[model samples]
Target: MSKTIESIFKPHLKPKEVYQGGKNPPTSNGKKIYKLSSNENPLGQSPKATEALLKAAKHIDVYPDQTDIRLREALVKDFDGQLNANQFICGNSGSEIIDMLLRAFVNEGDEVIYSNPCFLPYAVFSRWYGAKQVDVPLLNTTYDLDLEGILNAVTDKTKIIFLTSPNNPTGTYIPKSVLDDFFTRIPKDIVIVFDEVYRHFADAEDYISGLPYVTEGHNVVAVNSFSKTYGLAGQRIGYCYTTQTIANYVRQIHKPFLLPITSIEAAIGALNDTDFIAETVKTVQVGRKYLTAEFDKLGIKYWPTQGNFFIIDPPLPEFEFTDMLMEQGIMVRPVSQFGAPGKVRITIGTQEANEALVKALKK
Candidate 1:
């Protein structure tokens, strides 16, 4: 008799539900469809990045630099040499870098802590690695991270703490004062993984990036991505900056040539196109302001956002509200899966897309 598939794999590896993002909406009667579901850049990729991608396509047969030296150099220059080139590690996406860190640090039955309704990958990956998940609930109504609750949840078993500033779905961020205090309280042996994929879009005066903690000799790993800010989502390039010790450990487990040559070139090109980055930030800011004003006029309540997206508590059921938007040829994400049932997350898109959304709501 053939062996069962489950029997062949590790017994601890039970069937797990994977996280799903927004789906592409179908065209309705030739109506224009705007996808505000996945938080993608509405203005599209930079021309310089496109040019670099096309140029690198000519050398598809060649392997990428295993060391990722050029991309690291560009990042160092991008930050004005605030970080060293040797401290960076490139991956397929920010998600991949998080997974790599998990693999490098977490052992079976070790506890991992994070806020609920956060980036679900934290929970999914923790379970995959046999780590105990300690999810501290966010503060009610405000949807802010409960720093005290998180600190109280810690124990000797805790291995890593995942923090997403300007967090996904809710878009609320940890202020500098809160983070500074929280960092002081956290145990030194426990690793802190700061997912800052949305860092570029944040404009709040109190907001702070995690890079400073890494530079200050804390056990912090700050993950970033070219996907959102650079409009190179399709290229799938992400990276992290940390101390040499942690960076070395993550690099040891990484496979060579994981990044494509085109992706590397595209990221470098995106870095060089400073004007494009500025434009994307401005577009998101303008679109966000317009939507918030419309929401106010319509008496719609939404969480104030620092990221490019915001959460809304609709009068109708979350899924039902999403379906209504779908009928209007607009696709926004229902974020019940993020543990915030009855709320929907909408991406701030281009001027046309924002107007389309407001028009649909006005009907």
Candidate 2:
């Protein structure tokens, strides 16, 4: 006789798939766990950021800058007037900013276009709002963005196009020339959500982040995170820069005082620590090359990467490969959940961790 919970829910709401984060490496029998799953900065956070957080702890009772104005101004200064404070909106993480983009623009039955095996939040959140996901499959051989396929898939119903540099799992990106071609062909009215959270580690000669498009006043919203580059994943700070029009819409939904005081201060500190950032990028570059060379020596097939992580097309099934890696006290990401079977993504970690990963794969 009890009233059912489903009866009161909105008719459009369906059971959405939960996002799977990287697992914690288990410590069993005194084995050291090397976590290479989440693509986190294995080097850890900046000392300057740590100092800033500790200093800010004295003012725990105080609220954060309601406008997040300080971080916005820093970003403006960081980018050197290519953008202004009014064009940015800081969020808890890049994921939240992506979600906000959907909230501000996508309506029911709208179509969101993105490559398959991409950052899952785009699909997950689009469905949360009853939007249809139009996934363009990756080219089988290269595992890169199928720009031709993407163009063929677009329709008038499309509201947003999600693009990532050094894309998730595969770590493949659309080359600048390809992006330019696509932009010229695609409708300018459709919003492009360009996620470049891993930009700092990407050293490819032809790579270009979305900021240039934003400066040209294209309908592009570029999202970057302090998580990976600044090693502030724990702090959960990120920002999105876009046209003034898009920023105004996001501001309507993104309330003030959303970010905390400690996180804000740490992010500011992380931004100013240019020496730490340069060193981190250099280390990641070295590690990336080391892992790639090791993979080649092992005769393992991997996608060339611009990001700190690379994808391996392992001989064994992905789940089995992951289990084997776990037994060796190293954790790597399996891409079955990301829609690629028999493939795994490995984060390029410290020299020691990278060496250990290759050793485990050899067995």
Best by lDDT: 1
**Cα miss at 339, model 2 (Å)?**
1.6
Candidate 1, lDDT over the whole model: 0.90
- The sequence of per-residue lDDT tens digits that candidate 1 reaches over residues 73-121 is 9999998999899899999989889899999999888999988788888
Q: Could you give me the TM-score of model 1 versus the true structure? A: 0.97
- Residue range 1-363, candidate 2, lDDT tens digits: 788988888655666576888887675778887899998987899999999999999998988788888999989988987888999999999998998899998999999998878888888888878788899978888877888888888899999999888788788887899889988888877999999988888877889999888888889999999988789998988999999988987799988899899999999999999888988898889998898888889999898998888889887888888899899878988887787777898888989998888889888
Candidate 2 — worst ten consecutive residues by lDDT sum?
A: 9-18
Clashing pairs counted in every model: 0, 0
Clashing pairs in 1: none
